[model samples]
Target: MAVKVSSQKDTYKATAVFLVLMGVLYLLDKWIDFSDYNLDWVMQKDTMLLYAAVTFLWFKSDKSVGLILAGIWLIQNIALVTALLGQVSTYLLPLTLLLIGVLLYWLSSK
Candidate 1:
């Protein structure tokens, strides 16, 4: 099926928002002292991409595309995400799979 023009526009808007947010975040990291907060992981590229993926999923009309991309990003960066979760890392995979399944079922129903 062909994508609607409005869907494409939404995707573009999502991308622009992601880029601008990332830029602001990077600058903030550089200029601010966040060491006490231990939020360095939030500035990582993988984390940013995950955020972008979620943003795309939220904004895109064709959710399957965003879902696929988000899944790929999650799979590829599982280690980073898991590490960020520390003691909760062991539950990450199962939770992620469950969430994906739910999202897929929901999207298919729509």
Candidate 2:
């Protein structure tokens, strides 16, 4: 099915929300000295979260192209999440993204 104009509007709104959320997180982390984590690591995590949210929102909107990108981002970050979390998270990386997708899909419905 073709994506409706309303879906496009939803996409834009989702993008705006995601960006604002990331900006706030970044500032809060710096302001609170949340962690002495590596900048690259944090950036990667943020990117993953951003795309996952966007992807789920876009999917229901019939935005196939965006879904491809979101899936790619999640795929690229899978190793990172696993390596950082280690054996304790043998399944966490995939599950995390899946959970994100499910949550975002549900949230977008409203």
Candidate 3:
């Protein structure tokens, strides 16, 4: 009973911190110029929301949810993420798939 109450309180605290961080990031994005740095994508609304969601989930003990969300975000923004990798981006999908397969096999063995 006490553990559940503490967990709920921690979750509320995490939620408040997440909201504050998101608000600060949103304000910074609007007030600053990131175009020259080629980092405007980092300040985009969707990106910020995804980051906040991942952080919130991880802090709330929902690590798998955070990982899955982060993975989805990476897939959705792979082009942006690998923009500097050039040709390397082309092999990312297969490499990622292979890694996932290896992870599954290792987990199953465990």
Q: Candidate 1: give its CA RMSD in angstroms.
A: 5.2
lDDT of 1 by residue, 74-96 (tens): 78887777888898778876887
Estimate, for each residue in 1-110, the C-alpha lDDT of model 3 and write its tens digit.
Answer: 98788778767876778788878876776777566668887777668658766676767764565677677777777777788677876898679879998998999999
Error of 1 at 100 (Å): 8.1
Q: Candidate 3 at residue 15, lDDT?
A: 78
**Global lDDT of each candidate:** 0.79, 0.67, 0.74
Per-candidate TM-score against the hidden true structure: 0.63, 0.47, 0.60
Steric overlap count per candidate = 0, 0, 0
- When sorted by TM-score, best at the front, the candidate numbers are 1, 3, 2
How does candidate 2 fare on TM-score?
0.47
Best by lDDT: 1
Quality of model 2 by C-alpha lDDT: 0.67
In model 1, which runs have C-alpha deviations exceeding 4 angstroms? 1-3, 33-36, 77-110
Model 3 C-alpha lDDT versus the unseen true structure: 0.74
Model 2 lDDT per residue over 1-110, tens place:
34567776767776776677678767877776545655455545747565556745654465665667666775767777678899968677668868988999999999
Q: Clashing pairs in model 1? A: none
